[model samples]
Target chain A: MRDVYIIGAGIHPFGRHDLSGLEQGVAAARDALKDAGADWQDMQFAFGGSLAAGNADAMLPIMGLSTMQFINVANGCATGGSALLSGYWSIKSEEFDMGIVVGFDKHPRGAFNADPKASGLPQWYGDQGLMLTTQFFGMKIQRYKELYGISDETLGKVAEKAFQNGSLTPHAWRREPVDLDTIMNSQMVSDPLTKFMFCSPAEGGAALILASEEKMKQLGAKGVLMRGASVRTRPQGSFEVFSPSLDVERGGTPTEVASKAVYEMAGIGPEEIDIAQIQDTESGAEIMHMSENGFCADGDQEKLIQDGDTKIGGKLPINTDGGCLACGEPIGASGLRQVYENVIQLRGDAGDRQVPGNPRLGYTQVYGAPGLSACTILSAA
Target chain B: MAELLDKEEILKLEPLAEGLFRLDNGVPVLLGGKNKETGKIVFPMPSGAEAERFDVVPLKRTGKLWSWTVQRFRPKTPPYRGPGDDKNFQPYAVGYVELEDQVIVETRIMGDPDQTLKIGMEMELALEPFELGDEDKYVSTFAFKPVA
Candidate 1:
């Protein structure tokens, strides 16, 4: 396989928006192409990702319909990462020299209470209030705490960092810095996870332009080399959201499965990563994912938060972009939003939230509903 | 067996299948399937042979609370058809119950509010009214009650 590099990244600020999903996607795409110093015609292919929006490729008419291979994809919360993987492989396989990946979505306020029937689940599942994403996060964390001794304070610190980081991020939705006490005292959505710890289902768009090694040189564009791109689904027995039942014996969750292959593919270990952007749908999620993604050991989150190891000036700066906690999760866009932040950080373009010392390697992982995960590794080229 | 026959007129409610749960020899049990090949048991047998051939079995009536949380707000509708409207919405407990280390089933916990739920607490399955039905009858669904 040939090498693939990301030439440009762009995002529409995450939050409630009056613009149509298509318009938001179009804007992100436009910004990315402009940043890449390329024209719409230069894109050999386009892959669009969104959750509720139907056929993202429908935006072709507004995007200069160059008759490129356009495909629309939906992978729940990991939709953006899936689109990025598609574009990455397109260039790596030498099938297309360059491509565009865009993800956008709009959702109503309140908990993401999904219709069970839509996903082929029994309606009673939803009727029983078992379908709320908040419930899943709460349950997962509750179990994690039971086995690991994770404290509410540790969980609060995660949100505190996110809001603090979000305060510095212009594109983040919840830009006000929140204190640990504020997060802990916020109304409880589910036991363990307070309302403030949960990310709002938001509206936004993110886009990236990827080119083959030769194309990058041709355009004289310095880009972040794609070290690894992978997507995985839950194995039987792995506990996850929306599952009616789980196997008594645990198996590797999607994040663990996907990140293992990602590390192998990148020929590097988690110890080498300078920065990371992981799925933080809730503060506990970020804490659990830190261990699941192999960044740290299980039950290590307490010390990690207490010692400030994950903060910006710390050893492993995570979610420098404020993460889903601060940005509010615009499902389809959230995954790629992580990648965009990593790119900007590696490029030394991130202003206030930049990690100290020149970071070379970055990692990102996004988890989707009903069990799906995607990971991407990028490095300064 | 007696409760099943006595409540024959009361429907099982929408989305609650006819054979999902039943009283066997006076003991409530969830209908499940055990894979002969892998010895893996799944609640409500999954469709298709690729899921492995399984023998229908009655799951354990009692289990231990594996994990839990309380839904502080009522879920939106189109899928949720439980009791109470937005104005009168009441919080409810939800959790996964482990049935003897075989499988963990998601279930609604029936009990008093503000009652602390700890992991590994014993629990037993029970049939309760889910929604009111035609006439004086009502739809009954399964819920897990704390076993004292």
Candidate 2:
């Protein structure tokens, strides 16, 4: 099998750019090309993920930007990750020596138009008041409090941690300081999840350049080998309560199952990982990620956060790019945005938020499918 | 979309081609429809008992703020058509009730969206109209009432 590598990476901040969707994508794509020391003409194909099509009008971001070859994808919040998966496969399969994956979107003002007719929620209006991702995740936070006796103080502390880190990143949606009192008093967006606990919806774009080993050698790019990339969906569908893709009882989910399969195939373990990013659509999700990534027990992800191990200077830095928590939750751009953090860290470009002791192995995870999930593990050559 | 079948009709539908728990044993249950596209058999979320049964016991909730968020605008599905006569219900509390059985079900809350939500609070599910009604049919949906 060919060893594919990420040669280029670029991103705009996680808030609204006030630019057209295609313009945002083009800007990011140009940076990616420049970062890789490769030009747009050198890209063999392009895959784009944009959550809001209405904002962009006809001809997608990829079609507007790339002339050679293209495909566009949108899987709810997982669109960005899906784009990366497709680009990786294209280059790894020798269909293209180099592939460009771009994800960008300015979230619609309110709830995303999930076309409720398609989602099988038992709601009268599909998911009028109850379907926002924050509401569902808030349910999990409530459940955790019921079990662990986590204090409101603890949750505020978690919020403070994210904001403190967000302040460090110029691209974070929220860069202000949030103290324990500020987090506790913050307005509620969902139950148990204060506004601070929830990642804001922002307009943003991120791009990645993928190249086969031979292509990277020709270009002389310092790279992280795309060790393994895999995607999985719930056997039943996105809403099935019994999804193997998320947190199961004792073990990680089908998404974790897919990710573990990647690690097994690459002959690596989670302990070997140095830097990581997991999708945190909600604060509770970051907890689930620890156990899902073998960092903790299923309901015990909060302990990791509470203990400060999930912090920047702690063991195995995560979401070092402020995560989706600090970074805005741009549905189409989130997944690839996670991947961007890992690439920046691996290539040693991360400035203040950079993990100490120069990390080698990094992983990025995204969940979509109308709730399908994907994890991509990248490592230094 | 549920029909409260009369007791007699409920007994008569038994021995259906499907839905039989066991022929002459327990209640027969019918599962998913056949997937004509994939020529594959599929069964959606299945329930062994009905709300009326109330026998097997629902895992009760002690308490918890399962999660909460604002419904910034009206939904795009049934029950919500343009602005109804009364707009008092705009931006309502959207939440999930985490039953003791680890069951997480979505619901509307009894309080305001900006209210402080405590996790692990006792929660009970109640049926209500999905939104402001048209004075005709009521679309039944679940809502959570804190079990203080």
Number of the top candidate by DockQ? 1
Model 1 stretches with alpha carbons more than 4 Å out: B1-16, B45-52, B132-137
Tens digits of per-residue lDDT, candidate 1, A151-206, equal 99988999999999999998899889998888999998899899888888898889
TM-score of each: 0.94, 0.75
RMSD of 2: 7.8
lDDT of candidate 2 over A179-249, digit per residue (tens): 87877787665556677777767788889999998888899987778888877765432232312111112
Task: Judge candidate 1 at residue B16 and give its lDDT.
Answer: 54
lDDT score at residue A250, model 2, on the 0-100 scale: 28
Q: Candidate 1, residues B47-143: lDDT per residue as tens digits?
A: 5564458877888989999999998887877567766677787788989999995788998887664688999999998876565221333466788
| Top candidate (lDDT) | 1
